[model samples]
Target: MDLIEVLQHRYTAKAYNPDRRLPEEIVAQLMAALRFSPSSVNAQPWHFIVAGDEAGKARVAKGAAGPFAYNAPKILNASHVVLLCARTTLPPEHLQAVLDQEQADGRFAGEEAREGQRKTRAGYVALHEQAGDLGMWTQKQAYIALGFLLLAAGTLGVDATPMEGFDAEALDGAFGLTDKGLAPAVIVALGYHSDADFNAKLPKSRLADSVVFSRA
Candidate 1:
């Protein structure tokens, strides 16, 4: 399909056919698309809880029941459901390597790196940030992943509904992720559409073109 046509036609499916399933290879390709998503200092902060089994999917479905819980069977019918969990802590090795690279490139230099550290710390002490350098970077990384997943699903002709309409702690525990230190930020339900679930009824909302512009 044409690139614009694919995106132009995208929409979130509210209901789904319980028998639909996505191939493993297709899921892998979707993740491959995620690899290209940009992140601050390349500290990819997201980790996924692949919940495809009946019990696991049921657990998530029950926990997320607002307008989305009704379609639990439809999503369960998919080959798998992905729980987008983000580690609250920066992966140590990734940070070490990034800091090492910056140190080597002399971009931060020794004293400048020291100053950056000081400023970052100040951001926390003065305004309440934690985990120092990792705090800001980690938050930025999650958003990058979210955007990537949206476009990747679109590219594959798969319908997805990205949601933030549930409890995070409840989801974390249901997925047994507290031990893993990952927090659930978004819940996206994915699969092939059942015609009624198509974007036919939804129009994209936007700010007026005149209401948007560049500073430069």
Candidate 2:
């Protein structure tokens, strides 16, 4: 299907068929999409934890307990769940690591090019740090990846539900993300909708283009 058609039909599935599992090939494509997601200055300050089995999903479901109990079924029943995480801090070592990977990937023409790339990335990181929004900035980058994953799922005829109603603190503790310099930003459930999914029968609703867009 075309992009327009996919966008028009895609909806957040409220219930999933637990028996359904995504093909390994499709899961690989989705992982690639997340890995290559664009971020400002190519900061790539994000990590993804994907749960594809019963036990793995149960661990991710821990965050959905108590006040977030409503979302537990979605996580548990879905074929897979992805926990999107953002870096808690962007230190100099992380910047160096990015630069080193770029160089190893042949992204530089020479040492001069490598140095220039390093300086540019550092400048942006410093700016965010000075603004006292480094953490927010990283989280925004992770959301960009989430958007990519959602669109990729739609194109692949997969039902995806991007959820943020879980308890982040609980999730971090469950995953020991803090010590790893990471924090949970969002979670997404992927699978085929079940017969009980009432949302499948609903019409899509959104504001008119005129109200949401500007000519300027």
Maximum-TM-score candidate: 2
Q: What lDDT does candidate 2 reach at residue 100?
A: 93
Alpha-carbon runs more than 4 Å astray in model 1: 66-79, 91-137
Error of 1 at 171 (Å): 1.5
Model 2 agreement with the true structure over 124-183: per-residue lDDT tens digits: 988988999989999999999999999999999999999999998889878999999998
Regions more than 4 Å wrong, model 2? none
Overlapping backbone residue pairs in candidate 2 total 0
